[model samples]
Target chain A: MSSSTPHALAESLCILTLKSGIWVLFPITVVMIMVGILRHYIVLMLQSPPKKQPRAAIREQRALIRSQIIRATSANSPIPPTYYKSISQHLSQAFADGTYLKDGPPKGDAPAPTAPNPLTDPAAMDGMMAGMKTQMVMMVPQMVIMGWINFFFQGFVLIKLPFPLTLGFKSMLQRGVETPDMDVRWVSSLSWYFLNFFGLNGLYRLILGGENSADSSRDMTTPFAAAANIAQPGQAQDFNKLFKAERDNLEFAEGLYSWVGKDVDTRILKKYGRLPGEVPR
Target chain B: MDLTTSLQKLAAYRPKQSQKSKETFEKGVALLEHGGYLKQGDEGWDALERLALAALDQDNLEVADRCLELIAERFPGSPRVDCLIGIRMEATESPDVVLKYYDELLEADSSNAAAWRRKVSVLRKMGKVDRAVEELSALLDTFYTDVEGWLELADLYASCSQYVPILLISDAQNLMSARYTYALQSLSHALLLAPQNPSHFLQFAETAYLAGDITLSLKMFLTVVDMTDDDDGDVSPSDSIPTGMTLRAWFGVKLCTRRLLTEPRLLTSSGSQTPAPSSSNISTLDDLSTERLRTAYLDIKNESPPATEKELIAVLATLIK
Candidate 1:
C-alpha cells in the first residue's frame, strides 16, 4: 500500500506540471512571438533612408568650420579705412538734397489742412433741409402719441406694445387684462406679454428708432445729401421728401424709407434724368 | 269581480316592457321622434349629439361617421356639419387626415389665416420644413406684414446655414435682426469662399476680435500683416501696419506707447534678429516666449499712453523687449 501511494503521488505531480505548462508557458510564448512580429512591422513602416541623416550631419559640420575660419581671418588683419570719410561726405550731400528741403526752412512745421465742409453745396444743402422738414412733419404725431402713452402707463410699459398697435391704439384702446375668469382671455394676455417683452417688440422698436434717427440725421446733413445725390443724381429731392415723411409720421407710417433706399437706383432713374448703371461722380 | 282579484287580473293582462325586436325598434323610433338626442331641438344639433354619443359608446370612428351622415342628410347646408366633420377628423390623431379637414375648411373659407397657420405647423411637425417655408413665403409675399411667417423663414435659413438667403430676406424686410451674430457667422464662411484675399483676412480679424475669439483674431491679423507688399528688412512693426491711411502714421505712436516699462536691445550680431534689452530692469523682466509676447502685446494695446518721445521710448523698450 505504501508503494502504490508513492506511485500515485508521482503521477499527480506529472499531471500538475503539464497543466501549468499548457495554461501559462504556451500562451506566453505565443504572445511574445506576436508582439515581436508587430514591433518589427511598425519599425519597417517608420523606416527612412540613412543617407539623409549623414549628409545633414556633414553639412552642419562644414558650416561650423567655415564660420570659425571667417572669424579667425577677420581677427588677423586690422587695416586703416581711408574710404569711410569720403563715403560719409557723399551721404551727407545726398541727405541734404533729397530729405532736407532746399526751399523751406530746415525743420519748418506747416499748418495742417482744414476739415472739408460737407454743406457747402447749395442744392444738396437745400434738398437735405427739405428732407429734414418732411421727417419732422411725419414724426410730430408719433411723438405726441408717445408722450401721451408715456404719461399714462409710465414710459417703459408704453414702449412695450407692438409698433403698429402702439401707434394705432395710443390713447383710445384699452387692452383687456386677464382676471381669474376667462381662460382664453388670460392665455392671450400671457401670450401677448411674452411676445411683446421677449419675442421681438422691444428689440425691433429699439433698432427701428436708432436706424430712423441715424437716417434722419444723415438725410438732413449737407455732406450726406451731397453724397446721396452723387450716388443717385435725380432722386435727391425724392430722397429728401421720403426721409422727412418716414422720420416724422406717427399716425400713418410705412416701410417707404426702406423700400426707397433699396430701390434708390430705379427711383432715381424714374424721377431724374439718370440712367440705370450710371456711375456717379 | 272582487277588488283584489280585479287588480291581480289587470296586472297580468297589462303588457310588460316589449320583448320583441319590432317592439324595441318602435321604442327607439319613438325616442327619436320625441327629439331625445337633440339639445335645443334644433335641426342639425341632434346629429352632432348623436355622433358624439356614438363615438363615445363604440369608440369607433365608423360609427361616428354614420351618425354624421344622418345629420348631413337632414341638414345639407349646415356649417355645423363641416365643423363636426373637422372635429371627427381631428379626433383620428392623424396629421394628414387633420390636414385634409383643414384644406376643406380653407376651400370653404379662404380668408382663414388660422387654418393656414395650423396647416403650416402640422407640415413642419411632419419634417416638411421646406414645404412649410414655401407656404409661409407665399403668405408673406401676399401679406408682407405677417411677421410670424418672416421669422419662421429666417429661422429655417439659419438652421440650415443658408446665410445668403437669410441676408437677402432680412435686407428685403429692412430689419437687421440678428445682424451682428449673422455678420460674424458670414465672416467665418467668407474665409471658405475666398481663402486668399488679404482684405478678407483683415475682416476676419476684426470680426473675430468682435466675437471674442482672440486666438483666431491674432492669427488672422498676423496673416494679413504678412501679405502686404512692403517688405521691411525684418518682420518689423512698420511692415505690419496696413497702407493707405493716416492710421499708418499712428503705428509708430502705438509701438512707442506701451504701459509696461522695459528696454529695447539692438542686435550686436547679424544672426540675432531680436534687439537686446538696454534697460537696467532686464534682470527682473520675464523671459521672451510666445505666451509672454502675446500677453505683453495685449497689455500695451489697451492702455493710456505718453505723447512725448522719452516716455514713448521707455514704454516701447518695456513692451518690445
Candidate 2:
C-alpha cells in the first residue's frame, strides 16, 4: 500500500487539472457549434437566385443537343433513312450558316478573336463579387474565433487525452503552452479550438442535414476551385467554333446512318425469327 | 383502417389525372378535418399538393383555396406554390384570365418553366393551336431537356394533321404531310432524350403508320418488340405470350403487316429510297405476328373470367382475320 501512494497522488493531480480544463473546452465547442449554425443561415440569405439566359443563348445550346442526338442514334440503331437525311442535312446547314450562334454570323474574316477581359464584363464582375461574399462569410467568423482563443485562453492546458502519444505530437497538442517536459496528450485551449473547428463537421451534418453550408473543410479547397474558374470568367464559349466542330461530327455520322440503316427492315425481320433464311440466335 | 394507417396511406398516394378524383378528394378532406395528418413533415406537403389537385378536379373550390392558402403560408413566394395557385385558378377562371396570370408569373421570373408550359396549355385550351405551337417551340428552345415538352409538341402537330379542311385536296395533302413531318421530327427528339424508354419508340411507330409510311412503321414496331423482350429466360416457352407493352407492339405489327399486304403500293413507294424487304419476308413476318397474337388472346381467354371469352373471341376474330 505504501508503494502505491505516489502513483495515486499523480493520478489525482491529473484529474484536478483536467477538471479545470473542461471550462475552456466546453465554451469553445459550444461557441463553434452556434457560429456554424449562424453561418449556414447567413450564407443561405446571401445566395442569389440563378439568372435566366437570353433566347438566343438557349437556342444555341439546344441546337447542340439536337446534333448530339443525331450523332448518338445514327451509329447502332435503325433510324429511317429519309428522316436521317433530312435532319442531318438541316443541322449541318444550320451549323454552317451560323443561324444558331448567339451573336449571329461573325462580322468579318478576321482570325479568331481573344476572349473578352473578365474585369470588363459586368456579368463576370457580378460572379466574382458573389464568390467573394461567400468566402468572407466563411472566413470572418473563423478568424475572429481563432483570435479570441489565442487572446484569452493563450496557454491554458484544456484536456489530457486518455491514450499515449509520441513526442512528435507535443507541439501540435500544446500549441500555446510552453512546457517542453509536459506530456504530448495535454491539449491546450488553442489546439482544442482547432480540433473543434475541423472535427465538428459530422455534428453539423447531423444537425443541419446533408447539404448545409456549415462545413468549414470545404472552404479549404475553394480557393483552388475559384482559381480554375477565373480563366472562363462567365463561361462564354465560342458558339461558332462549337457549331462547326459539331457539323463536322454530324457529317461523319452520315456514313454510320447509311451503313446501319441500309437493310433495317430485313435485319429487324431476321432478328425476330420472321425471315425464312436464318434462325434468330 | 385506423386513422393513423389511413392517413399514412393517403400521404403515400400520388393521384394521376385518370384516377377517381372525387373519391380521393373526399378521403383527403376527411383526413385533413379529423386527424391533422397533413401538418407533419415533407411528405405532408406532397400530400397537400396532391389533395389540392384532387379538390380542383372535383370542383371543390373552397377546399382547394384553403389548401393553397396553407401551402403558400408555409412556403412563401415559392415558384412551385405559384404554379399550384395558377392551376387552382385554371379550374375556375376563363382561359384569358388564366393566361394573364401565367404571364404575370413569367414576367416576375422569366425562367419559370411551369408557368411557360401552363401558358401554352391555356392557349391550346382556347383552340388557338398555331399560337400554342409557336409558344411551346419557344419554350423548348430554352428548356431543351424537357422530354414532356417535346412529346406535347409532337401531339399538337399530329392533332393538326387530323383536322385539315378537305375542300382543297392538294393543299390539304401538302399541309397534312408537313404536319406529319414536324411530328416525326419532334418524336425523334423525344426518343433521343429518353432512349431507354420503349414507349417513345411505340409512339414513333404509330405516328409513322398514320403518316402513310408503312415500312418505317413496321420497322419501328419491331424495334419496340425487340426492346421490351427482357430475355430473362423466365418465360416458359409453352405458356409465353408477350404481355403489356410487347403485346401492344405485336398488335401494331399485325396491323401494319395486314395493311402492307393489301396495299403493296405503299411498300414499294416508301421503300424505293431504301431497300424494301422482299415481299415473301413481309408475308412471313405477317404470319408470325398473327400466330403470336392468336396464342396471346387464347391465353388471356383462359386466364380471364368466363364471361369475357365471348367478347375476347369477337375481338380476336376481327383482329386475326
Candidate 3:
C-alpha cells in the first residue's frame, strides 16, 4: 500500500471491501436515527413538570422585578411624582428591613460570613437532584450508544469519501484504524458514529419540532460545565444582599427620576402649533 | 363553518367582554362533544378550558363539568386545573364552599396566582369587600406586575367609595376622598406597568377627576388625547377632530376646563399638588376642546336621522355655549 500512489490505491478498492463497508455503514446509521427519535420521546417522558415556588419566594422575585422596573422607567416614568416618592420610599424601607425575605431574617444578628452549604438545605437538594436527573437523562443513552459502536465495529473501515481530505484528518477520520499508509479519506466506523452523533441535529429538528431534546451535542460539553453548578443549582437567593443592592438602585434612580407626563398640556399644545410663542419641544 | 374550521376557530377564539357566552358555548359544545379538537393537541386543551368558562357563564353546568373532567384527567393535581374547578364550584356552590376550595388549592401551592385571585373574587362575591381588599392587596404585594390585578383593586376601591352614604356628609366626604385616593394610587401602579395603554391613562384621569384634582385630571386627559391622536402633522389643528379615546378625552378636557374656569381656586388649592395650567392656557384648551367637540357632534349629527340631527345640533349648540 505504501508503494502505490494514494489516487491509484483508492481506485484499486475491491468489490468485497466496498460491500463490507456498506454493511458497516447501513445498520449504524439506521440505528442511530432510530435511537435519536426514541431519545426525544424518552427525554420528554422523563422530564418533570415545573414546580411552583412558594409565596415568599415569588414575592422576593417580584420585589426585585418591581425595583428593576422602577430603575428602568425612572427617566421617563409616567407615574406621578408623589406616588413615585411613596412607593420608592416604601420599597427602600422594605428592602432594608428584609420584609420580603423568602425564609425570614437570619437567626443571628448578622448573615453568616460564608454562604450556607446548599446540600444541607432540602429545597436546594431537591433542585440539585432535578438538575442531575435532566443531566442523566441526556447523558446515559449517549454513552451506551458510543460504547456499543466501539465494541461492535472496532477497527472496521466504514467508507472512503469521494473528495480527497488532507493528511490532517487522518487521526480524526481513522480513529480505530492504525494503518499509516491508508488514504486520509478512509473513515473508521467509530469516526462515522461520532460524525453522525453531531451531524444528526438538523435531522432531529426536521423530524421533530425545534424544541425537541434529541440533540445531544450540548451534553458533551454541559457535563463538565454543569458539574460545578449542580452542587448549588438555584440555591435560595440571598434576599438581604439583593434587597440592599436594589435599594441602592432605587436611591440612585431618585436623582434621575422625572415624570414624562408632567407637562403634557403645553407639550401637546405646542405639538399642533396651538400654544402661543412656543416651539414643539 | 365546517367542523374542522369551526373547531379551529373556537379553539383559537379569545373571550372578550362583548363576546356572547351562550353562542360560544353552543359552538364549543357542538365541536367538543365528539372530541373533534383532540387531534389539535395542546390547542384542544385550550379550547376545552375556554369552553368550560363559556359553559359556566351560560349556566350550562353539565357541559362545564364534562370539559373540566376531561381536562382534570389529562392534567391531574395541577394548580391551574384546581382553580378551574374552584371557579366551577363558584357557579353552583355557596361562597363558603368555593372559598374553602380556593384555600385548599392555595395551601397546596401558595404562589398559585389563579387560586389567590379566585379567593379574592369569592370574597367580593360574598359581600365581604374589606376582606377581599385585604386579600387582594396581599396578592398584589406578591404579584406586583399583574396589571389586571392593580386595575381590579382600583375598581374595588372606587366601588367602596360609592358605597359611602351621603347622610353623614362630613364622614362620607372624608371616606370618599380617602377611597378615591387609594383608587388613584392603585391606578398609578397600573400606569407605571403599562404606560403605553391610553385606557389606563384615561382611567387615571377619570379617577383624578373624581378625586377632585382637576389640574392632574386635565393633564392626564390631555396625555390621553396626545397618546390616541393618530393624525399626521399635516392636518391643521382646527381641521382635525378627535375620535374614540381621543374624543372621550376631549370631553374630559371640556369638563375639566369648565370646572377649572368656574372655580379657579381649584388650581391654587393646597389639595391639588400638580402644576396647574395658567388661566390663559386653560382658556385656550377650553376653546380647542369646544371646537373639537363641536366637530365630533356635527359628524355624529350628519350620520343621524333628519329629526335627530336638528335636536343634536341644538344640543351641540348648548353644549359648546
Off by over 4 Å in 3: A1-14, A105-113, A131-140, A226-233, A278-281, B1-19, B161-170, B231-234, B270-272, B303-321
After aligning candidate 2 to the native by TM-score, how far in Å is the CA of B86 from where it should be? 1.8
Candidate achieving the largest DockQ: 3
Interface DockQ per candidate: 0.01, 0.37, 0.57
| Tens-place lDDT digits, model 1, residues B1-321 | 443332222211211223442343344345555656555455335434343444523445665665677677776844445545555655557989878877876776664444555566666666777777677555443333333344455445444333334444545322333333344433433332344455655554454344333323333444444444254345433223334221221222122212113212112221112122333222222121122233333455765455554564465455443
Q: List RMSD in Å for every model shown.
A: 45.4, 5.9, 5.2
- Better model by DockQ, 2 or 3? 3
- List the candidates ranked by TM-score, beginning with the highest: 3, 2, 1
Per-residue CA lDDT of model 3 for A1-281, tens digit only, reads 78888656654653346568789798888888888888788877866566678898888778898888777889988877888998899989988878888877556666564666777877567667766766786678778878887898787787879999999999999888777777888888889988998899999999998998777786676765544565543555667888898888899999899987788878777766787766543
Model 1: CAPRI class: incorrect
Q: Pick the candidate with the highest lDDT.
A: 3
Order of quality (DockQ): 3, 2, 1
lDDT by residue (tens digit), candidate 2, B149-244:
888899999996543345434775567666776788788778767878889988988888777777777878877877776555665322357777
DockQ of structure 2 = 0.37
- TM-score of chain A, model number 3: 0.83
**Which scores better on DockQ, 1 or 2?**
2
Tell me how far the alpha carbon of residue B205 in candidate 1 is from the true structure, in angstroms, after superposition: 30
